[model samples]
Target: MRSLLSRRFRATRAVTAATAVLALASVTGQVAHADTPAVPEFDDGFGLSQVTEDREVHSSTDFSITVTTPEVAGQHKIRIFLPSDYASEPGKRWPVTYFLHGGPGNPDEAGTVEALRSDQMITVAPDGGRKGWYADWLMQDTAEGAANWETFHLEQVVPLIDANLRTIPDRGQRAVVGLSMGGFGSMHYAQTRPDLFGHVASMSGGIDFGNYAVRGAVVATELNLTTAWCAVSSSRGCADYGPVVDSDAIFGSPYPVFNADHIWRSVNPAASANLAKLADTGITLYTGDNDLVENHTADGVDIVTSRLDKLGIPSRAVNYGDGSSLSPTCNGGHNYGCWAPAFADYIPRLEAAFAAEETK
Candidate 1:
């Protein structure tokens, strides 16, 4: 968590990828949290076998699970937050909210969900990988063959929760929310598998990757320096973290001059086909005027918000002007301060979606 926050604050200023990686590379060893000891250690989620290292986090309320599946290499870590009354009411099933974190991001980013104090909704957060971008990579070597995030989350994680936990197991009982890159994943997952997630919300997520180079560059840079790549790198007995690859490994190229651009367009939530599938899924998009690199986000969230309006997709739009005031709580840009408030506002809305169906 220390490295994640350090990288975030510095990255907010448009720093180079090398600088960002170097800044946190040293601290990456301090990856696991004391309260949550089960979290993956150095080179976590980037493809390192930390399965035996798994342990429960936050006692009975919030626990972590290591899932093994063919969707991606390495052991997957998921944090599950059960309702306080879960043990008291053994037969009572509950609604679920899937929380996705950002690049170099963890499932419990900034303790966003914990701060919400919960809403009688089960919170299931899966490691979307550090910059996994929640997609199966276009190339194997691109992500060092450790992609397949979408399949892992939807096919493996989702079912594992439903079967093991007392969840409603219906689309109306499920919602997905994420910040930054996970934001893109939530919206795309909902759009692609409308039957899986009934409601979806994105916080400062990059919805249109094709329109902005920064979006692609960010992904490329993060992918290049993955933990899996670093574990094998010729390090001087230190966490090298990466050998420094290129965007080509992930998408072939950052721009649309080549065929790889099509992959970007395809995964984009704002794309015509993607948007077309959202008619049945409740959609919400959020971004702050004071957010870091707000312009690049506009090409994503803002444009998608506009397109949603134009397409008449039932959606909620929160500008959270400058991320000020708690009246209608809106935090600052891409940071957790912004996300905590945004999440505080969105969680109830998500529960309401589930409640609506429950009453029916």
Candidate 2:
């Protein structure tokens, strides 16, 4: 039964073909928290094996880029797969999808490779920032913490990939997906830069950062801001732990607005006015039944769905019966172990969407 399900998860040719086309055309491209190990190192020639004739896998230890953000310096390594037809048919363009790793600290090389093997699509994962929420600073002084992340991604990373790799060059061919912090990043990127990605997906994402902060799931010290605004606006002096601020002065009036705005902009699909843009671009949302962060996931889905409905934008959401958030399998939890399968299941749908767009 498990094997059968796995087979079902594999990418179909229709999807593979579309992905290949988008990837080829996208010359455009495009994180951290830590104390955790730096992104993992892989063998230079590592690649995925095709589960089917239509799929092919490729991995490169050299598939990496480094960005020196104003606040932090980091390296991003990526693993990619090109469909069997990609090399054979040199003239084609393929759509691209980025997979984001959870934990902000975890590296996504292996699972990314696995998903590529089954899907025969272009995929990449970059390490998230050192334990930060990938936000823009609320205040200029706190730019290092979260604000720089946006610059690192939009300026440093995307341009590097487009210059270095054989990929689709336009935003219409690109998509983003991730788990936990990565999931939040995926949605946040799509909202912030609708012109850069065609679709976005979040799996058990930490989508409600405002709620999390309010609940104290996020430590005050980890936040670097005089108020959160300062953190959002500037990378310097952003860590609450690094420097003491007069909270009495900074916390009350405008800081909360920045916090609310940040959250509202990041996951509140309605706030970005991008739902119509997503409908035009083919965005998708998904989560598991047993995602560890059930409340956030549910809220994300509900909010996006409600917004999309009001805007009359067509979208799809999936909830696997498996409740475990760590494993991708039926018993896996919210981590990669659980998301890999969800990714596998979604690849075909993604491909089909791409294919449909191409024909039109």
lDDT (Cα, tens digit) per residue for candidate 2, span 223-321: 433343222111132323343322221122223554543434434444536455565656666665543355456666767777788888777766654
Strongest candidate by lDDT:
1
Query: Which residue runs of candidate 1 sit more than 4 Å off their true CA positions?
Result: 1-53, 110-112, 115-117, 223-243, 326-331
Model 1: worst 10 consecutive residues (lDDT sum): 229-238
Model 2 TM-score (2 dp): 0.63
lDDT of 1 by residue, 332-353 (tens): 4456656776777788777777
Q: What are the TM-scores, per candidate, against the unseen true structure?
A: 0.77, 0.63
With candidate 2 superimposed using the best TM-score fit, by how many Å does residue 218's alpha carbon deviate from the native?
Answer: 4.4
Per-residue error (Å), model 2, residue 102: 2.2
Candidate 2: regions farther than 4 A off: 1-62, 65-72, 84-90, 109-113, 118-120, 139-147, 209-277, 289-292, 321-328
Positional deviation of 303 in candidate 1, in angstroms? 1.5
Most TM-score-accurate candidate: 1
